[model samples]
Target chain A: MATGWKYRTAEAETAEAIDRRCEPRRPLGLRFALMRIRVETELCQGHGRCYMLAPDLFYADDDGYCHPTGERTVPAELADQARRALMNCPEDAIILTEET
Target chain B: MTDAKKYSLEPPEVARNPHDTYREIRDNAPVAELAGRSQTGAVTLSRHEDVMRAFQTPEVFSSDPGAIEIGNIRPLVPLQIDPPHHRKHRKALDPLFAPKQMSKHEPRVRELIRDLIDKVVDQGHCNFHDDIAEPLPSTIFLELLGLPVSRVDEFLALKDGIIRPPARSMEERQEKVKATGQKIYAALEEVVEARMAQREDDFLSTLIDAEVEGQPLSRDDVVDIGYLFFLAGLDTVSASLECMVAFLAQNPGHRQRLVDEPEVIPHAVEEMLRYESPVASAARITAIDTEVNGCPISAGTRIQVLIGSANTDERAWDGPDEVDFDRESKKHIAFGAGVHRCLGSHLARMELRVALEEWHARVPHYRLADGLELQFSQGIRQIDNLKLVW
Candidate 1:
């Protein structure tokens, strides 16, 4: 026969379990968000203008081909510039999106 | 042009039909001397065998004085360094650009390529240079260097000043180029300083911490290497892609082949590199007196290896002028050779493959806009404006 209820130590709970228990009560505004840029290769001619303009967000291949970096965490000041790079691509290869 | 006279090195014959000129040179004089302002004269190796031999033997032909003059700005690293020393610098950076290492970034590259294609797939009309080629690599370069994306305009202007100097006096061009170099140097310095303070996980930070022989690289070394990576990664690849697109627009059948058989992209890329080499010529100083194609060359003599001509040489390739994606024996000097071979070769191939694959997959039919004026600059072969309609 069970005496009553089981007592679990603080260390016994996993992050997922804590999240599941607190999810319903927590407010949505406190959650972290993410944003990303998408590139369409068919449109890209590898002009490398993006690389020239935004060395931080773009890189090129040995043949002067262009590709985006994985981490798209734009700084507050650089958001507008990143957007411009996306908008100005001669190939229209870049697409920007935000996710919650 | 008379057969006896040397070819003027200035104002590269971008507009002239390259094939006709190449044929004339090949028939009249396979090896001719090139006269330029800075260097008195250099032997021009036009035939494929000669060019291949010259590029392969770096000890004999050195890329020390640069393939072409870029006014006042110092020549970028690795590209300007001859063997031994060049190998050391290349060794330091090669691992970062290996095929397997670059493959890790493929998904991101594919994503960029796809998004770019989607934008103009519906429009059916777009200026490819402005819409695609120019921006894609520019953005990519910035991201790799860990610089501020906001400074792209500044970067473009500086790169243009160096790569495409305004049609002005030499002195004026030199002044502008020097200023541009200083700006780039300052920017790189600032990035290095900031990264050192924060010690973040980025390429810039890694470079800052990189040591050679138990000593960290000097500020100038960092700046020079950074400059090389920027220019090499940006301009050459961009120009090659532009040429590829232009060729596809002109040759519907070849373009259709790529569309129908995506598996042939890698081979197709090799063929394109052979057909339209962006780097037309590279200069090398004769380290020792050497004889090329039976002509004796003295030490210190500059030699211009015509890579574009080599790609089209009749002896090396069948129907070399034609864009045959199915060519069985396709070996090209597009990425150069030996110790000085491009460190980013794999990266360049991946980019080209992805660009061609995604482009053909989306826009199955496209044509160059009629009456579109094509402008070509010296030292680099790239279309200034490429208007397209699909």
Candidate 2:
């Protein structure tokens, strides 16, 4: 069967990232990739899956639309959460990109 | 006549399933125009990406003209109003479906389902929709709205008319649909005025007494909001329940799975909803000139997002047409997307899940009554008289 729902950019490790353990264990010993989370607001249907499912990284608009608040870029420590929100988005409107 | 020529959103038939037509358009003409004089400037987005894009960009594709009910141009609260106003309405209304409310009422909902099933269980046969699916959701919703229990049938008629009116001339059907809407609106208006005089414990009374923008809402605001709830919350859950049951009765393997492993019912419900989306397309008016899938659409154009087709779009799902309860990531736009998404989604999910659990506990072995037919409503895609026997 076709694998899971994450729609990622070319640079991010698509298959390997799904297996990576990023359970928010503080004090990383090694360097982590910088991640950027975005909602192609035009494609977001505001299902609240992204915000409701991943509250730490997302909060809904007053209109219950996109959660475009807080640090637009996430530290390596929070990359797992950003990925969860990426998979959770029903509209597939949420995109995740990692900076080299 | 060709399929396109013969296609009517509301055609008169005993056992018509419009999804077959939806599939035809989705494959050949993903952005097909409405074929009649009545549907004039309307276009349906059969592709999933296009449907998602239209709703996600509400600034360009507004629900103001009407989302659920057509030409309801007067703005039916959050349902028909675009954002800013729509957000405020949702802020006030969305919390009503809080988990606390469901925790308090779900046991009661389960009891209600059992009692209704008990009435027909001994007969060894029953019309499933009328017996349980048709009445359960409406009963719970009306009780929430605090509408009198004695007037269930009356409100049921009004709700059904808005969603699935009898197939007739475009002018005639539109007239009936609007008139039904007016009756609902007038009912809310009367209640809002009365509640203003003296409050009650019902949701409507609370809404009447509530404030937005640090100012009390006008009668129109409360009434229109209530009217939208009446039209939306009334028949949608019931329609979904009916659809779920119809599918279960025919597929013994899936039915047995649910009965054997009750814990999977919630996931099963999501799969059922994805496979059989109760509502089809929701309407949006183009607020500005836009292009969907490269097809240029002018401002004021009516875009009907084919939600049913989008759920089954191969571009999104692994096997879009197959019903896989165990499938990973079952996120479908059955309730819609964006700020104008279905406000009653939480309630609908609870009801569908509870209904499945309670029914299987009692009548786990029921099957479609032999020689009987399953006829789904054209507009809302609901089964009215699904006969089942154990």
Off by over 4 Å in 1: A1-100, B1-16, B34-40, B71-75, B169-172
Best by DockQ: 2
Identify the runs in model 2 with alpha carbons over 4 angstroms from their true place: A1-85, A92-100, B1-20, B34-40, B66-73
For every model in order, the TM-score on chain A comes to 0.54, 0.61
Among all windows of 10 consecutive residues in model 1 chain B, the one with the lowest summed lDDT is B1-10
Q: Return the clash pairs for model 2, or none.
A: A45-B337, A45-B338, A46-B338
lDDT tens digits by residue: candidate 1, B157-185 = 77777787775565676677677778777
> What lDDT is reached at residue A29 by model 1?
53
The superposed Cα distance between candidate 1 and the true structure at residue A10, in angstroms, equals 48
Return the TM-score for each candidate structure: 0.74, 0.84
